[model samples]
Every structure is written in C-alpha cells, then in structure tokens.
Target chain A: MIRLNRLCAGYFGKTVIQEVTMEFLPGKVTVLLGPNGSGKSTLLKASLGLLPLTGGEVLYDDVDIRRLKRRQIAQKAAFLTQSRNTPSIQALRMVLHGRFPYLTYPRHYGGQDYAIARGAMDATGSRQHENTNVSLLSGGQRQGVYLAMALAQDTRTLFMDEPTTYLDIGRQFHMMRTARSLAREGKAVVLVLHDICLALREADRVAVLQEGRLLCLGEPDAIYQSGALEQVFGVGVHRVDTPHGMQYYCVPQQVPGRIAEECQNT
Target chain B: MSSLRIFSTRRSDIIFWAGLCALTLGAAALGLWTGSVKLEPAQVLDALTGRDGTSAAARIVLYSRLPRTCAAMLAGAALAVSGAVIQTVLDNPLASPSVIGVNSGAGFAVALVCAAAPLAQRYTPLVAFGGALAGVLLVAGLSQRTGASRMTVILAGVAISAMFSAGIDTAVTLVPDAISGVTDFRIGGFTGVTMAQLAPAAGLIFVSLGIVFSLSQQMDILALGSDTAQSLGLSVGPVRITLLVLAAALAGAAVSFCGLMGFVGLIVPHTMRRLLGKGSLSLMVSSALGGAFFVTMCDLAARVLFSPFELPVGIILAFAGAPFFLWLLFKQRGGRT
Candidate 1:
C-alpha cells in the first residue's frame, strides 16, 4: 500500500537516507536490517511523513503523501517510534490513544472506541494489565501495551521501530510470532530489528541498508545468500536444517571473509 | 473487565471533584469571614446577601473580602494550570511558570511598563502577557534548536529567569522613583485589588482555562514524547506552542495583579499529579480545585496567622513552595515522577 521512490530524507539540511526505493505490500513482514547509523530509522520516519523529504516523494497507494496532513497520513499508517515516555497513566488509556487518528476536533472517544481498544488489548494479551499503571509495567509488558496500541489503531499498515529491544528471549519469540501473525492477517508489517538472525528468519522480505543506501531487497533467503549481512554488518551467517525447517544464525566476524566460510563448513 | 476498571476510575474522579469542591468552599468562606474586623459567619453571609447594604460589614465584604478572595482563587488556579501545562510541554516535572522564568518575564515587562508609562495600570496584564509569551517562546525555541533533554530545558529556563531578573533590576534602577510600587508588584497580594483591576485578568484566565481544558487529550498525547505524538497525527509543533502561549498568558495575568506568586503552578499540579495520574484532563481539573483551595488558605493564613500584621501572600507560598521543590528534587533522584 506504500511505495518509496528515490527517497532522500534527513534532519536539518543534512541527508542521512538517500536514493532509497522499496514497496511494502500486503501480507508481508518487511524487516529492515542494518548496522548502526544506516538510516533505518530515518528511512522509516521519512516513509511515515515524520521527517522532511529532501528529494523524491513517498506515495500512499498512488498519491504523493505531501498532500496528506499528519492526521491523514495517520489514517493509513500506525507508527510506533523508538523512544516513548512513561507517563503515569493507565495501560488501557495508552492503547486508547491508538483511536486518536480516527477522532475529529475535540477528539472525543465513545463506547465503541473503548470496546475496540479492549479488543486490541485482548489481541496483544495485555488485557490483564489494562488497569495497571504503564510506568510500573515490566519492559516486556510495556512493549505489549505499545503493541496493543498499534493494534488498536486499526490501520492497514503498522510500523514498529525497534520493537524487540528490551524484550527477553521468550518475549522476543512472542513478538516475532505476533508480527508474523499480523502479516498473515494481510496487514503490511514493516519493522526495524538489530538482530540479523531474527530479521532473516522472520521476515518475508529483507531490506538491508548500508550507510544510508539500500544494499539489497528480496526474499529473506536470497538476501542472506547474497552475503549482504556480512558486507553491511561484518557478520558471519550460516544456515542449518532442523526438523521443522531451515534456520539461520549470525555472529560478528572481526575478520570478515574466512570466518563466514568457516562457520558454514563447521 | 476493562469496563469495571473504567467505572472505578470514573467513580474516583467524581469523588475527587466533589471532595475538592467542599474543601475549596470551606477555604473560601474562611477567607471571606476571617479578617481584622472579626466578623461572624452570619455577618459574612448577610454581607454577601446584601442584607447589610453599605454598612461597615457590607463594605468590607464587598470591597476587601470579595475582590481579594476571587483574586487569590483565580490566581492560584491560573498559575497552577499554567505550571502543569508548561511541565507537560517541556516534558520536565521541574518546568513551571515560575521556575521557567514565565513570572520573571511578566515581572520584567511590568517593570518596563512602569518605567515607560506609570499611568498604564490598565495595560499591565497585556504587557505582561506579551513579555511572558516572548520569554517562553525563546526558551522553547532554544530547547528545540539544541535538541534539549528534559533537564536541559529546566536549566535553560533558569538561565533565562536570571537574565529577566537582571532586566527587572535595571528597570527598577533606571527610574527608581517612577516605579515605587515595585515591591507591591514583586510581593503580590490581594489586599487593595479593586474589582476593576481583577476583572480583566479574570477574563484572560477563564479564556485560557477553557482552551487548556478543550485540549487536555491532545496535551496527554504530547506528554508521550514528540515522535509518538507526531506519529499519532498530532500537530505537535503548533499544539505545543499554543499550550506554552496559554501558559504564559495565565501566568502573566496572575503576576500582573498579584505579583509573582512563586510555585503555585509547580506545587499544586505536581501534588495533583500524585493524587491523580498524568491524565491531563483530570490532572488539570484537580490542580485547579486544589490550587484554589491552597492559595485561598495561604492568603487566609497570611492575614490571620499573625493577626493585626498581614504578611504578603507570596511570603507564605515561598515558605511552603521552596521546601516542596527541594523534596521533589529528592524524590526525583530515581529519575521518575
């Protein structure tokens, strides 16, 4: 539903993401993979109209997004930014803000809105904590609340920036599973993750960025085989076959070329 | 399950509003009745009802008790609400109108007005509002340009406040004889506030209060941080500026009439946030009620605590507020409030 054409975006007259092109289709978990300062967040913000575009335009369907107001863009995309403040408010209230894009001036919410928010909480398995103060929640529980908020937004596209950061291993599995299920439900799921193996294993399509440039975009397996992870992140990846299916694991390689081949052979 | 939670929360909100109303009424009545004249509650009521028309009791009630009480309550609510909004906008608990130089900005402007046109008492609030808005905009603009952290905003505000204080001093020294009422402007009291002086400031306070209430939900979203608020489709820049402008207006109007009553904004809203939550609507409402009661009681105490020798209301507020500020600093060591 969204397309980026030669997009160049940055802050304060300095371009960090330059000449990038990609498409986010329905029923796909498109994970953006990159090292530090690779413009992953900037590219995401530019796509969501959160940053000023210096060059090419972003299109929502066929129309340029500049024609849209923040509210209008919000109707099409529910964006979860990287950093969030912990205000001492109810978790349910946090989720209810997902209905904000649908609200008009005076921004009133009603029974239906509350019902929808509750339903979202249920979907994210966070209903139990609805009455709890969000600030007091554990890191994993807080991420769950934020995920519930995105679910409550009820948009066709959801963008999560580093959703897995503070999650423990078990919670990471749960988050990845949720993202996969969300894509299966035909929503465009675009996320940025630092974990190479997690991104490669879970993503339907992987987009690797290097120094603000798109290195590769294809099926996860193809991108992995292209050595883009090693090239961009200096990481060694090896594929292993298990009872269920093929899985990939990556480890940082101080000396790039031989370590990956060694990992594959072993 | 969520509905049950909602119901309980709503009930609590109702309880809070009702309880605050009772307390505010009691405080206001005491303010009206307890004075140097030693009038009874019956005499106060009779004066209020106009049954003692033009009598000594009636004149005291009409001229002294009524204006001062209204001034004290309105000033409290305005300053408290302003501080709350400022704190939210800057995303710093320590950011208040008084702390962030909003009052000092108004004080500086009032001093300039006194120096330039001592006959411009009618325009003091307006002048103060302009000064306050300019000061807040400068501070906010600086913070934004520098990409400030929460603590940085408060620091910037303190620096700006200090600069304004210097300007105020210079203004006072430039024509010390012209602005003889500088202490009255600085100390802030309701004692001689004619209804004429209170009316304009009251109008500005009410209008500003209305706007803040209407935008409470938006303000809550704003407290969520700039990126999240913008992602949620809030016009963060405009909404933040609007909130800051209103905060300045509220503080400016109050300071124009009552002098810089420090920490009413900081103390009342911070306390209300603890009693309630950070829900902007409830926090603002509770702050208003709590502030009205707090300032009224302080005013009453200033007049009666050492009867026959009234102290300026600001003195009492400073005594209470400065320690509360220190306590907040102590509590915030863990970096969450």
Candidate 2:
C-alpha cells in the first residue's frame, strides 16, 4: 500500500499539485482522471519522489518513502512515464533493464533475470517482438514493451502516467484490460487516464481532479451517479444501461436562457 | 544483489569481436612495417622476437617504430571509448570528444602548462586531464543553467570549444617558445613519443577504461533518458556525473599523448554501434579495437604516403572523417534512431 499525505510539488518554484492526500490500496485499479494540466501526473510523480515534495510525505507500507534509497523504493514500486523515448535496443534487452536494481557490480544479467523479463513480455503481449528493436515497434507495441518493463520490476505497486496515449482504440482497451488483470493479481495499479468512459468502465475506482484539486474519489458508478464527473468536466454526462453493463457518454451543455433568447431573435 | 547478465553471449558478438581483433593485429603489423625505412613482415616479426637485437632493422623497429605504434593504438582506443560514453550520457549521437570541445580543452591546458613551465613536461598529461574535466563541467554546467537539452549540450560544447581554442591561441602568442611544444599537440601525431611519455597516459587510460567497463550497462540505461533511468532505480545524477568524468579522463589521457586526434572517438563508436547493436559492453570493446586499427592505419599512411616528409595524422583523420560524418547525417535523416 502507498499513501500520499498533503503532497505539494511542482517545477521552477511553482506548485503544480498542492495539499493532495490519496491512498493506493493493493488489488485495486485506481485511475486518476483529469483534463490537461490538472495535476494528475504531478501527484503521481510527487508520490514516487521523482519530484521533491514541499509539504508532504509518501508512506509505503507505513514507512516514509523519502527515507528509503532509490533502489529500495524501486523494489517496492515501479513507474512507467507517459513519454516513451524508445531505446534502440531489442525489446527483450530493454525489458531486462527492469531487473536493474537486482543487478550489481560488473553489471551482468543472469539467466533467471532474462527468464523473468521474458515472462513479463509474455504477460504484456510483447513476447512476439522480443527479438526486434523497440524503435521498430509501433506506438502500441512500444507501449506494451514499456508496460512489460514496469511489470518486470516485480514490485508491489505500479504507476503509469497516460499509458494509452497515441495507441489505437483497440490497443487502449487491451492496455486497460492488462492493468485490470495486473490489479486482480494483487498489485496496486495506479494510472492517470484522459479517457473518462474507459476509466468508468475499466477502473475499479476513479479519482477526478480539476485545476489541481481532487473533486471526487469513489467507485466509477458512484462518482457518475453523484454528478461530480459532469461538474468537474463542465459537460453533461449521460449514463445508460445496456447488455454490456452501464455505459457513460458526454454531451455539450446548453446555456440556461440563451436558447430562449435565440428563439426570440429568430 | 542478485547475479545478472546485462549482455548475452551471442554468436554474432563473438564473431564481431574476433573480426575486430584480427583487424587490430593487421593494423599494428602494418604500422610497425610501413614507416620511412620499410622492413619486411618476417624481419619485423624476428625483430619483435629479438632474433638479432644488434641489427639496424631490429634497432629501428624496437626503438623507433614500436613505441609510436603502441602510442597510436592506445590513443585510438582511449578516445573511442570516451566518445561512446559521452554519446550515451548526453543522449546525443552527434556528441563526441571533439564535437563537445573536450579535446580542445585538454589541448589548451597542455599548451598553457607548457608555456608557464617549459621544464615541467612530465606534468603535461595530468594538467591535460584536469583541463578535460573542466571543459566537460563547463559544458554540462552551461547546459544545466540553460535547459540541458540535446541542442543545449551541443551548442554549449561549440561555445566551450571556441573559448578553449582562443585560450590555446593566446598561450601560443604570449610565449613563442611554447609554440614548439604545442605544435605536435595541435596537429596530433606520434612523432617523438617515447616509452616514458606513453606510460603515464597508458595508466590513466587503463584506469578510466576500467571505470567505463564497470558502468557500461548503466550507460545503456542512461541512454533511455533520465526519467526512465530514475524509474529503474538508478540515481541518475551520480551515474551521469561519473560517466562524464570517466569520459573526460579517457579523452584527456589520449589528447595528452596523441595531440587531439579527432574523429576516432566519434567514428569508431558510431561504427561499432552499427555492427554490434546498442549493448554498451560489446559496443565499447569493438570501438576500442576499431579505433586502434583506424589510428594505426592512418598514422602508417601519414608516414608512408609522402615518405621523407610526414603529414600529421589529425589531418588524415579530418579528411576522412568529414565525408563519413556527412554520410551518417544523411543516413540518419533517411532512417531514424
């Protein structure tokens, strides 16, 4: 389990995320949903110690993460950044980097490490291209490789920032399903996603942030039912029931008296 | 920590290393044989084995050509390995000792030290090493202050190189007597390099190479970008600083003895990467061998091409490297890293 208490962090002396408290429990897929520059990514980075917190502490299993060494933190959790600067190396070798903390002096990776990397790739559906260079992979395939690396870390928690961006619709669903499966396996899977419908359908819980503030945090159904999603997004959200289960969609809001004024002018 | 293997022992990797070993041996032989007074390969071998140490051929081979050949090979290997580390740390394929002004920085320091104390020639290599470190720090510091982006590093390198070159020019002007000392260094060469001079530089190169070898795997991780490296449990700042310092030491050691031999660092690593993939260990090994072969062969040409009169090996390298670099740029534009 990981908890962020009153976390405050940002770049160049300006706070991007302020006074945010959140907990990521094991066996749950917690998706952070927000618009651009809404501090979702900032919060995740701050919790990981990637960005220095000005006013908070991140506790990993009741211990302050700031007191832990980088390698120790990495052992407890793995992170996948949104930007994928794909290295020009074979997919298997790139995935092998996840075992880096386990590797020591002389910097050699053993058969067991390779096997673990292979397993991670297989788990992420990137096994087919293991022998190929990652630069040759498509965006979706590359994202799979990155996920494989995070999975290969073999940590208790995994954090991904926009893992599905630039991927096709099918790949997006595949990624979400992978995260769901990973959560089901008892790892805490945390993500910042832009797709609200996917978040509602795929995530076990959703935390919505607007303008660097957490507006709502609950199960997707409850959050949608409470009308917090619509209020946060400034759009009307419609929920419908179908054979596929509850479905949510967004519609542009209408002005209160502008319609009547336009009718009178016409 | 668990036992790990960062590089797989592939058949292709074996073949590549073997090929490089053969090329290095051939280049060393040619370098030993094709000087101003040519010696047959058999005679060169016999002289090397001390079959007749008193003979004129043996004397020339042992006393004159052997040290020069060793110096060329060592200098090549050092520069090439340094370039590989620099490129990885900076995440820029265009980064190299010469491009980033490390060579000029060392050269400037060597000239300044020689100018200030002409009799303190024994300290030249150490001063050069210090200058190289300073140069890299200046570039890194400037980049950090600005944006530390790829373009910022390159631009800062250019600016630093110009400043160092100006320093060298000033030193030369202020002390005309230092011109004689700085001449060979300015136009990098193997002339007049004795076993004594080669020994210190060799020690520095060897130590720095060991450091580089130990961290080669991490270098691959660093090349993936800082964010990725951090997530993988690497303390990116310390690792990057160590690599930069090692690279500067390697290049500085080479420049102290070989006089700013350019392109070997850039060309060798790039060539090795093309042949061996991005595994840092294999790339580094191949680059070392390839660089040695290239410099030894170029030095041989510099000696035998015009015979009685010698051209500086740096000129040969520049003439060859410029066209190849252009071709590389075009190829990169056509493809993608």
Candidate 3:
C-alpha cells in the first residue's frame, strides 16, 4: 500500500499540489480524475517521489519513501508517463534494465532477469514484437512495450499517467482492460485518466480533484451519488442504471444570461 | 533452455571479435608499410620480431613507424569510445568531443602552454589534459543549471569553444616566437611521435576504455530517456556524470597526443551503429577497432600522398569527415519533428 499524508509539491518555486492525504490499496485500481491543470500529474509524481514533497511525507508499506534510494523506490514501484521514446535498437535491452537494482557493479543480466522480462512480454502480449524496434511500432504496440517494461520491474505498485492518451478507441479500451487485469493480480494500480466514462467503468475507486484539492475519494457508487464531479466540472451530470452497471454522463445545464451572450456572439 | 540460448548467442559474438582482429591486423600492416623509407612486409615483420634486417629499415620501423602506429591506434580507439559514451549520455548524435568543444578546449590549453610556461612547452600533454577537464567541467556546470536541454548544451559548448579559441589567438599574438612549431601541431600529425609519448597515453587510454567497457550495460540503459532510465533503477544523474567524466578524460588524453584528430569519434560510432546492431558491447568494440583503422588509414594517406612534404593527418580527416557530417545533418534535418 502507498500512503500520502498531507503532501504538497511543486516545480521550482510555485506549488502545484497542496497538502493532500490519500492511500492506494493493493488489488485495486484507483483512478484520479481532474480537469486540465488540476495537479493530477503533480500528485502522482509526488507520490512516486519524482518531485520533492514540500509539506508532508509519502510512505510505502509504512516506511518513509523519500528516505529510500531511487533504485529502492524503483524496485517498489514502476512509473510510466504518457509517452516515452528511446533509440529504436535499444528497446528490448532497455526493458531488461528493469533488473538493474538487483544486480551488482559491472552489472550483467543473468537468466532470471531474462525470464522475468520474457514473462512480462508474454503477459502484456508483446512477445511477437520482442525484437522489433520500438520506434517502428504503432502507438498501441509501443504502449504495450512500455507496459511490458513496467511489468518487468515486478513492483507492487504501478503508476500510469494517461496510458491510453493518443490511442484509438480500441487501444484505449484494451489498455484499460490490461490495467484492470494487472490490478486484479494484486498490484496497486493508480492512473490519471481524462476519460471519465472509462474511469467509471474500470476503476475500483475514483478520486476527484479540483484546484489542487481532493473533492471526493470513494467507490464509484458513492462518488457518483455525491455530485462532487458535477460541481468540480461545472456541468450537470446524470447517473443512470444500465443492465450491466451504473453509468454517469455529463450534460450542459444552460444559464440564461451566459447562453444568450454566447448565442449573440456566434 | 535459456542457458543454451545464451550460450549460442555468445557463440555468435565470435564474429564481432574476428572482425575486430582482422581490422586491427590490416591497420597495423598499413601503418607499418606506408611510412617514409617504407619496408617490405617481411622486413617489417623481421623488425617487429627484433630479428636481423636492414639497419635503416629497422631503425625506421622502430624509432618512427612503430610509435606512430601505436599512437594512431590508441588515440583512435580512445576518441571513438569517448564519442560513443558522450552520444549515449547526452542522447544526442551530434555530441562528439570535437563538436561539443572538448578538443578545442584541449587545443587552447596546448596553445597557452606553448606561449606561457617553458616547462609546459616540454610537457604539453599534461597542460592539454588539464584544459580538457576544465572545459568539460564548465560545460557540465552550465548545462546542469539549465536542466541540460539538448540545444542549450550544444550552444554552451560552442560558446565556450569560441571563447577558448579567442584565448588561443591572444596567446599567439603575444608570443609569436615562443611557438615557432605551433602551426604544424595545430594541424595535427604523427610524424614526430616518440615511444615515451605513446607509453603513458596508452596506459591512460586503456584505463578509460576498461572503465567504459565495464559500464557498457548501464550505458545502454541510460541511452533510453532519463525517466525510463530512472524507472529501471539506474541512477540517471550520477551515471550520466560519471560517464561524461570518463569521456572527457579519454578525449583529453587523445587530444594531448594527437592534437585534435577530428571525426574519428563522430564517424566511427555511427558507422558501427549502422553496420552492427546497437548492442552496446558490440558497438563499443567495433567503434574502437573502426576508429583505429580510420586513423591509421588517414595517417597513412597523409604520409604517402605528399611523400617528403607530409600533410597533417587532421587536414585529411577534416576534409573527409566534414562532408560526411554535413550529409548526416541534412538527413537528420529532413527527418526533423
């Protein structure tokens, strides 16, 4: 489990994420949803110790994460940003690098490392393209390769920032399904998702943030009922029941004066 | 099953070793045969084994050709490996010792040593090494503060290079008579190399090569983006700094000996990347051998083409390497984002 206690962080001198307390439970997928520039990425970075915490502390299994070495932190959690590009030929060897922390100086990967990397490739369904250059792969294939690299780390926690962005509809759903399955395998998977519907469908729990503050954190049912996302997004939302599950959709509730002004301008 | 696979993979690596040996032997032969007072293959071999031969050919082989050959091989390997390391560390194909100003820094130091300290005039390599280190430190400090952006680092290197060249100009203007042989050194040659110069430089180059070879895997990891490297449990910052220092040291030692032989570092690694796949281990070894061959050939051309009036090897390399560099730049430009 990863816990954040009154954490604050920023770049240079400006603070992007305020004091925020949260916990990520294992065997669960926690989706963080927020509007643009709402500090969602910052919070994730702070949790991973990528950015310095200005006010509070983050703990992994009750141990202060900031005090741990970077390699140790890497062994505990794997972080994947939206897009990562590397040399085309170095792609597979790059994935094998996930075994670095376990090796000593003059490090060389042994059989166990290759086994883990191959296992990760198989798990992510990237085995066919193991020898392919990453740059030559399509967006979805590259995303899978990156996911395989993260999985190769064998960490308990996985942090992804919009892993499905820039992908087609099919790829988006495929990636979300992969994340859900990974969470089911007992890893704590945290994701920052822009697509609210996708988050509502895949997330075991949802956290809503606005203006660097956590407005709501609960299961989908409770968060949907709270009207927190509606207020945060400044729109009207309807929670409807489908045969499969609960679905939430947003609608624009017209304000008389603003609507008239926008119409006149158009 | 995996062990068998790895063993087979190891077996194929023999091809790379064989190729390197072939190139090394060819370059050594060329270096021996293409000097003034050239000896036949048998006489060169006889001289090499310290067997009886024509005294003039033996003396030429021992005193002149051998040291030049060793110097060329050592400098070429050092520069090539250093370039590869820098390119990987900076994640820029253009990040060569010459392009990024390490050689210019060493050159300026030699120029200054030639002008100021009489003792430094005799021990020019030490001064050049010191200057190279200082130059690397300056670039590192500037780039670190600015977040080491690709354009920023390159621009900073160019700016520092210009400043150092200006310093060289000033020193030359002040003490013209002090550096009567400065022109030939600046152009770079292997005509007058002695064994004494080759010995210490060879030792330093090997040490640097050993350090880089040991860290080859980590370097391969680092060639990925910084975030990926960090995620993979490699300490990106320290690893980059360490590799940069190692690259500077190797480049420095090479410049101290060869007077800024350009293009070997920039060209060799890229050629290896194209020929062999980008496995760091194979690329590193291939680059070392390729560099040695290229420099030896260039030096040989310099010796034979002009015959009695020897042209500096640097001129030949610049003439050849500059056009290739321009072609690469245009290709990269056409493919730009």
The numbered model that scores best in TM-score is 1
- Give the range where candidate 1 chain B is weakest over 10 consecutive residues by summed lDDT: B178-187
**Tens digit of per-residue lDDT, candidate 1, span A102-197:** 997667888899999999999889989988888789877887888888788888899999988877898888888999999999999999999888
Better of 1 and 3 by TM-score: 1
lDDT of 1 by residue, B1-337 (tens): 6688779888987888899999998999988988988888888889898788778988888899999999999999999999999989988888898888899999899888888898996998899999889788888898889998777888889999999989988988988975545676676677678899899999999999999998998988898888888878899999999999999999999988898788899999989888877488988888888989999999999998898888889989989999999999888876654
Candidate 1 vs candidate 3: which has greater DockQ?
Answer: 1
Per-model lDDT = 0.88, 0.85, 0.81
i-RMSD per candidate, Å = 1.6, 2.8, 2.5
Worst 10 residues of 2 chain B by lDDT: B1-10
What is the per-residue lDDT of model 3 for residues A106-127, given as tens digits with 9 covering 90 to 100?
4778899998988888887887
What share of the reference contacts is kept in model 1? 0.73
lDDT score of model 2? 0.85
Name the top DockQ candidate: 1
Score residue B130 of candidate 1 by CA lDDT.
Answer: 91
Q: How far is candidate 3 from the true structure (C-alpha RMSD, Å)?
A: 2.9
Global fold similarity of model 3 (TM-score): 0.92
